[model samples]
Target: MPKKSLLMIGVFLLATTIWAALPRVSNPSPDYQTQPTNDGSHVEKIRAVWPGPNPEDRVRARVVMSGEDIIFEDGPTSQVMNTHSIRKSLLSLIYGIAIDQGLIDLEATLQELGIDENIPLTNQEKSATVRNLLMYRSGIYLPAAGEHDSQITDRPAREEHEPGEYFFANNFDANALGTIFIQETGYELGPFMEEFLATPLGLQDFDANNVIMGDPWFWPSQDTRHLQYYVYMSARDLARIGAMVAQDGQWGGRKVIPKDWIELITAPHSDLEESHVPNHLYSHFGFQWWFQEETGTVWANGYGEHFLMVDPTHDLVLVERNFSGNSLLSTARWLSSGNKFSGSLWELIDTHAMLVKISDS
Candidate 1:
């Protein structure tokens, strides 16, 4: 065989092996229910409120669905974008499944799970249970991958609070939960997500290959023991997950996530008034989800203003995404433009107002 031909054959073999290793759903569910056509009035109502001034240029995609009908959708809802910290919420969903199957014990301490970091966790810190991490009350203050400067600055001092005594939105807890999930389940986050969550929910644009784990752009040289689990998902697909959560984890007449687990995750576990979270709209903290007690809303929030909001009160699911780009250079460029989408609870409120107005009319 010619040298060039041999090289091409070797490359082909490698690619085939890699492709074969990727996870696939043995039987993917049917596509999610969407309205045959978008309601024009609903579209106009949502559009009038969205991209409101600041978020206009940065809002990349959005999907608003009520029950089984997609009321409004805009931008490339199918385009995959880095979901930032929303990966934590996805991990929470997976945890619910794992816990139900006896793969993980919520009350198990970090010491019991053999969870540690490069800097080493104190014996007291190791006493924090898996449940504590889920509630962002782990009280482990070590630097974590994907944390913003504000989080680092505001992080409680070592031993400032005992396990489960305080609630600080620390990425360390979120990232460590990812590590625990992989350890307990013997499956990577991506494949587990595909087999357990995405397949069950019939997500339209989920690709296990796109799910990655690494340091955040600003914290590239951080600890390697527990990296951030970054998921790339489309707004439309996220809406499906939100809808499932809204319905108490049932999808297509099948119970995907346990109803009790869903309730536990969305129910407030942290002190509402004492938590150090920057957002006033987040009235309480659930397992890994954010809660607005007044409106009965649960949401998964990510950096760059990405949100997956499930408002069971109104039977509404809204997903918003701001493309931070895929590569470091592209992400840097996007950040340099000074157009990152902002607001968390306020954005949800604005969107919900539109829904309310449309409903009244």
Candidate 2:
């Protein structure tokens, strides 16, 4: 074969292989559950919120559903960005996995875990065990440890006692929870990730570790997908993950994540509605995962209104990547205060003009 012809054929085959894995456009309907697709319009003002001022920016937005990603960006079959604390939520997958394997007890107390330190944590914080931390109720005084709020402009930790300062303080430091996990459990992060979650999921091109060198160093990758590159992938893969959970952790009829582990990971450990906007009703956290609490929506969100949301009730998975949004925490607070989509995860994402996804692909 001519060298140029051979190259063309190789390209065609690669494209075909990627096409098979890429998502297909989903037919929509008013009813997507117990019936058919509830075709939602992509004509919202949301585009103003996608990351990157122009499509040329390294940032991209996406949306996936039912094993399809109708929203896409750039020219690659996969990409990357930063999911931030969203990584914490993914950590729950392992936590639940450990519990399901009888490596840890869900009901274990803090003292049982030997975590009650001399720190002045409140009774709520001290009594909190691994479960409370999963639920974000360890009551640990974050600002006390030097957390700072971001939007205050000139605000400093040594400034004043902000109303919600302790929890949301921008404090400019790694929350230490990541390192705490490895320290408490004696499990190395990278090796365990390869062993427990990544390998079983058939996921490569990712790394989860403390890639820093400071008091609270060890930053996880901003690329959440495809090996810490903001978890870059087609929406079909995201839906596949959700569908796996919806199907009780079964992937092509194989048990990837333990069944009991899925249930525990998705189940709530705290009050999600603690923050809501537009509608005050809410679903919150189940360990690191986000749940509607009311609608049984499980999610892991990022800096941009980047979301991987699943409505287990209706077998729906909706992902939104906005340029900037304050996320669930601030968004709900801003909304309850009777405002617009103020301080939302979507808004935070929109600010950077990065990537977001939503799909019925």
Candidate 3:
């Protein structure tokens, strides 16, 4: 054989050997699964800090990437935990679908939707529209259905700012959005989510049993408009949701959500630093997703450090959850206060830097 041909054959053999040495990932769900590689170095930094010194940081967490890569996971990734505000992001996806189908209108005012309460709303509050709620700019502070007392206590006064003029991470927005979905579709959130999202995404562990509905006692009004609900899901399932968003609503080659709607929701609408958010690495809020300005990534965040982030630039989905199920009150208090915990601030900054480094590496 010619010398050049022999050299080319040797190169091919070497490449094949290297490829064969790489690990393979299995996927029982529609999301792609790829084996962890040197790409997990950044994730290792996260794992090293897991169950950190603080009581608050000593919690469960799981991380996954696009292609369903098990980047870094600790504790039980399959354990269903209260998603808290992370539920809002899932709710946002439902809203996008509802709007795309013309089942709900973003411009529909609370009054037009017949979303009234036993306690009369100020005209400004009444003027709040679905769009305002999605933006967290409703400025309407009527007690939320599923919110705990701590959340309610933290809320601003009713109609504290004109509609479209303020941003507060109030549960009322999500609950009200839930009400709109039911009123318009004649289907409850659990069933609807299971059918449209969970089922389609091939979620491994989601069911009606995991659903937490609005507590009548916690609500400000008897009206269903004040009703709210939340879903508890596993980290892997949340990562699937993140992957779907990262892919612009496409999952397994299917258009699960409209691209335009995804763009609209992920686009920055409110600046959180301007809103006086403390220790906030991310500065902007999209529809329900939070935008990390530094990384150009968007995430669904919850109390207790539950997060599912999507970096479209790298086609990556990362998730971490601190299961507050065992210590709800303590966790809630810590999260609501926005205080630093277990070197989280430093770890978060380091993780972001590491991801960038790894991606560039």
Candidate 4:
């Protein structure tokens, strides 16, 4: 055979090997207890607030909690799907654990981490720290997978705010965090998530096999690149995470993460910057988690109305998964267009408000 044919054969075998290794649900349909008696009034309220004539058209899954138990749930709680940026919240969880294990130093600078690109980082950008990335204040301004172009356009000139003075919800921040994780620990995101998080939380659906890089094309062709990644988790497992957060990193009487770290990350760090996302009720961010002051609810929000909300005051954890109006690629383009999204903008607002009412009830 010609050398080129041999090369093609090698490539085909490599692709097939990787595909075989990817995680699949051995038991996709498991016996999940459904709480028919759990108060669904809040879900009904959300249905009323949603735009579509039929609520089922908008919401794909929901999980409501009272303390550690699932009080109510409707829709496809067992169905696994991409929750978009909610993966950031999981990254945040990993960060807390990483920090506690002394694998990462929040105070460490980019220069110290040896973090640099082929495109040279300005001196000011090099001065950023892990904390700055967590706060979305690095101001490094690299093109990230899920970021809107308008955000890039609106961003201050390079080095405008030093490291911590400005706040923008750029995918670069999260991607850089992923890079830092691998650099510090020598583990890719998937395995790290499985060993440290899924195992500890007793999650039924999450594992290294199911996790995939969030933006495969962002740093494509770069041999030394560390790509950002995301996880596909079911509503029930998402609630497990929420319940853990509500319990200050404890699950089933075990301390899954340091309680102090949980407090530090969920506490308000900076006010959210203005964006095309119109109906966000959150005012501040903490370690990638959003903080709503009026309701004392800390949440992990994703594109297209994915939410995992924790209200400690009422011992409630809620997870909502709804249809993304467009495909991920199309949604990325829509966001880049600088036009506001109309269809699902209100879901976050309505969900938060309803959670408050649920707690009050």
lDDT of 2 by residue, 187-263 (tens): 75545654665555543233333211222212343321112212232233344456566666765567767887788
Question: What local distance difference test score does each model get?
Answer: 0.80, 0.44, 0.71, 0.72
User: What's the true lDDT of residue 107 in model 2?
Assistant: 59
Write one digit per residue (lDDT tens) for candidate 3, span 266-325.
998898876735536687998988898888999887766777778887777767776654
Off by over 4 Å in 4: 1-59, 214-226, 273-280, 323-361
Which sections of candidate 2 miss by over 4 Å?
A: 1-58, 67-77, 116-124, 144-180, 208-240, 272-282, 293-296, 320-361
lDDT of 4: 0.72
RMSD each, Å: 6.2, 14.0, 17.5, 6.4
Worst 10 contiguous positions by lDDT, candidate 1: 21-30
Q: Per model, how many backbone clashes are there?
A: 0, 69, 2, 1
